[model samples]
Target: MIYKRLEFKNMAGQKVKITEIPVLDSRNPHYFLVHARLQALAAFIYNNPDSKTSYSFHDYLKRKMKWSDFIQLYRTEQYSHNA
Candidate 1:
């Protein structure tokens, strides 16, 4: 859940008011169901660090994803579709 509030401030020599931003809590329902899998995801991350996977993302993607995936992700900001 998030709480919204209003705030007042002085900007450019003028007094201005703005709506306060909402706070995001990881414990929320959606977050808990989705993004809150931090531990599992962390394990997954640690399980497949540096684009390397032990058992292979498939068998093909592993060997290919190892260094090449890192390269693709780093240079192109995307995973190789082939991998």
Candidate 2:
């Protein structure tokens, strides 16, 4: 999931830092976690079956939902192979 492991300037021309931490979430079932900047947004991380590459996307929920609802939806969503 990490393309490069070095600190570099971001698009804003400011120095950005990169740190790699080994984190595991059993409830998520995925090897990694996908976090969204906004609570109202839904985030997903998808791993390609045939490659080391993975794809991800984030989108706003159709309607305002509770945290439990979001978790339930994510668990049922197609993108996540996790239970």
Candidate 3:
């Protein structure tokens, strides 16, 4: 497993810490689970550092989610918000 530390600024401009772990493999069957995982992770990261999961956005993208799936989801959400 790959581990990393990441820092991100929320809308409030406050610096946050996130742990990045590459745990997902290509053999994983529940690909759609990444969306919920990402949402949960984002929520967890926004809280206290001690409460956050040991994973990062980059790691989530690389491990749990495919690039095309992420892009499609993002585009769909963006379009819905704009519409």
Among these predictions, the greatest lDDT belongs to 3
Top candidate (TM-score): 3
**Model 1's TM-score against the true structure:** 0.24
Writing each residue's lDDT as its tens digit, candidate 3 over 1-83 gives: 44445567654556766665334555654344754676677676665455333445665666656778655533423355567
The local lDDT score (0 to 100) that residue 7 gets in candidate 2 is 44
TM-score of each: 0.24, 0.22, 0.36
Model 2 per-residue lDDT tens digits across residues 1-83? 23222243433444433233223354753332333322112112111122222212222332344566545545533556664
Expressed as tens digits, the lDDT of each residue in 1-83 for candidate 1 is: 23343322222223222222224465643333222333343344444434222222223222433565434323433458867
Candidate 2 lDDT at 53 equals 26
Q: Which stretches of candidate 1 lie over 4 Å from their true place?
A: 1-23, 52-83
Question: Which is better, 1 or 2, measured by TM-score?
Answer: 1
lDDT of 1 at 12: 28
| RMSD (Å) per prediction | 18.8, 14.6, 12.2
User: Using alpha carbons, what is the TM-score of model 3?
Assistant: 0.36
